[model samples]
Target: MTDRAFRNLDNLRASASTARVLNLLRVSHEHGRTDGWRAAPLFENSTLNRCLVIKHRLRRNEIDAFRVRRYVATKIILPIDGSDLRVGGRYIFVDQVGFDAMLEQALGIGPSHPDRKILALIDELPSLDPFLLREQLRRNGHAPDPCYFNVSEADLMRMSDFVASEITPLVDLSIGPDADLAAENPVARLTAKIMSNSAGEDMSALGQTLMLRPEEYEEGVFCWKGFLYYKWALQTITGDIGWVVDSVRRVKPRGRVDTEQHVAIDRAKEQVRRRILITCEATADMLRVYDDAFRGLTREGRPTAFRDFLRDAPILFARLGERLGAIQHIVSFWKYRMTGDRSAPGAEELLDLLADFETSLSGRERPDVLALAA
Candidate 1:
C-alpha cells in the first residue's frame, strides 16, 4: 500500500460512523454542559485521534435501550478501524429515532464537533431510495428478503418496508419506550433470522458476492473476520515454533564433546524462528494490501475488483504452508538425530506424503527422496 492509501485509511478510521457520533458528543460535552455526554478517547497517535465519547444523558425509561446500543457499538463498531461500521441482529446499537435526536443535539449546540461533512454524509444515507438501501444490506450478507431483488412497484414497496421495519432497527436500536413495540427487541429477532437463514444452506451467489466485494460501510464485517483468521494462524505457528525451540533446548547436552549435536539443535531452532518471522512479516504485508484493496475498491461499490483479493489469499497461504512444511521437515531431521526416534509425531507420514506428491509431479520415481521417506 502507498503512503496515500495509508493516509486515506487513517482518515476513514478517524471518521467511522460511531467515532463521528462519539466525537460530536465529546466536543459537545467540552463546553461545560452537564448533558451527560463524555469523551472516551479510544486511540491517539500523531495523525489520528479515535474516540468513543458518546455517553449521553440516560432517561429513566431509556437505560435498557442505551445499554444494548453501547454494548454493540463497543463490541462491533469501535473495533472496526475504518468504514461506516454496521452491527446486525442482536448487535444493532443505535435506532434511527434516538440517533436522529442525538444528531440534532450534536449539530444544534456543538460548534466544535469535527467532520460535519462526514456526519452529513452518514445522515444522507437514510434519504436514499429504500431499494438502494436494502441492496446495501443484502450486499453485506445481511440477508434482506429475496423478494426485494426486482424493480416492480410492489417489490420496491416491500424493499421500503424492509428498510424501515427491518434494516433501520438493526442499524440503530435506540428506540426508546414504546408500548406498541414488542418487549422482545428487534435485535433478538434479527439474530434469530440470521441464524435461521444461514443454517444448512449453501451460500447464494449474492452471499458470495457480498463476502468478496463488501460495501465500504460493511468493510468492518470482513476486516474483523480477517483479523480473527490472521490471529489464529499466527498463534498456531507460534505454538509450533515454541515447542520445537523448547525441545531443542532439552536435547542440547551440557558437555563440550557433544558440541556438534548441540550446535545442530541450536541452529535448527534458530532457523525455525528466522523462517517463521519472515513468513509473519510477509503475512503482515499481505494484510496491509488486503485492507487497502477493500477500503479503496468497495468505496465505489464495485465487487468485481474483490475477486483478485480472493485469488491472492490462497496463493499467499499456499506459499506459507509450503515454507512451514519445509520447516517441519528440518525439525524432524534434527529431532531424529537427537532422540533416534523415527516415529517423530507426523514427521514420518508427512515425508511419505511429500515423497509421493513429488513423484507424481515429476511423473517418474526419484530414488533419493524415496529412500529418505522409507
Candidate 2:
C-alpha cells in the first residue's frame, strides 16, 4: 500500500489532472487530521487519482506480486506532496458580521449576548506572559515565531479542534434545533439586505435627505449608493459667509455683488458645514458653529444668497426629515433655540416627524430620478 501510494504520488505529479485530484485528497486528509479526525488518508478523489496514477505507471514492471505489495506499504508511509496542497490564492477576511455569526455557531452565543462574545474567547487565553508561552512552545520543539502566530488557513483547520472543544457546546445550548435554520433569522436577513443594497439607490436617497439649506447651512453633497446626495451646508455659515462678505467689500467695494461670487461663497460655506456636522464630535462644537453663524447674521445687510437660502430652508429640512430624522430633529431643536422659536416639539411630534420621513422613502425612485432630484 505504501509503495502503491508513493508510485501514485509520482504519477500524479506527471499529469496535471491527476495531480490536482491527488493534491485535493492530501488537503482533505491534512485538514481532517488537523480537526482531530483519524490521522489517515480517507479515500477521496485525490487519493483515487493517486492510486490510478500508480497503477498506470507500474503496470509494465515485472516485480513479483509479493514485492509489489511490500513496496506499496512503504510508499503509503512516505507519499510525496501534491499540487492540491499548495496555497496559491488570495485570502479575504470574512465580513465582521459573518465572523460574528461563525463565532456564535462555534461558541453557542447570540449576537447581543455579551457573556459569550468574541472578546470573551480572546480573554480566555492563558494569562501567562507571551514571552513565557513562546519559550515553552519552543522547548517542546515547535518553532514559536511570528509565522507560527499568524493564523493561516491550515492553522484555522488545526485550531478547529480547540474551537470544537470550547465552542460547540455553547453553540448547541444557544441555537438548539432552530440553529440549523440560519436563513430564517431576522438579523441574517437584514445583514443580507444591507450588503446587497449598500451600493443601490436607497443610499443616494438617504444622502439627499441629509442636505442642508443655504440660509440655514451651506451647499455640499455626499455620494451614496452610486449617487450624490446634498447635505446641510454648515460650512458656509462658519467659513465662507464672513470671508466672502469681507472679500466682496475689498474686491468690488461699491459695485453690485456678483451673483456668481455670492453663489461660490454659499457653496464654500455649505462644504464647511457638512464636514463639521457629520463628524463625530461633541455637541458643544456644533453649538459653537450655530452660535457664530447666528451672531454673524445679526450684522448683515443680508446677502441675497442668504435670503434665497432661507426661502429654500423648508426644502432642505423636508429632505433631511427623510434621511436621518433623529439627527434632523436634533438640528431642528437647536435651530429653534437659535432662532428663539417659542414652541417646543413634543415626543409624539418627534415620532410623527420620523414616521413621515420613513413614509416618503416607501416610493423607491429610479436611480436617474434620485440623481437628478438630488
- Pick by lDDT: which candidate is best? 1
lDDT of 1 at 200: 19
Query: How many Å off is the CA of 349 in candidate 2?
Result: 97
Candidate 1 Cα misplacement greater than 4 A, ranges = 1-231, 236-251, 254-257, 295-305, 323-374
lDDT of 1 by residue, 278-370 (tens): 544554455455555454344555554444554444334333323333333334444444465443323333323333223222211112211
lDDT of 2 at 121: 29
**Each candidate's lDDT (Cα)?**
0.34, 0.29
Checking candidate 1 for backbone clashes, the offending pairs are 39-53, 94-172, 94-173, 95-172, 95-173, 95-174
lDDT for 97 (candidate 1): 34
Model 1 scores what on Cα lDDT?
0.34
- Candidate 2: how large is its RMSD? 31.4
Q: Candidate 1, 301: how far from true, in Å?
A: 6.5
Tens digits of per-residue lDDT, candidate 2, 239-312, equal 43344334322321123446665554445434333432433132223223323332333333323322333333
Candidate 2 ranges with C-alpha deviation above 4 Å = 1-25, 28-30, 33-53, 57-59, 66-77, 80-374
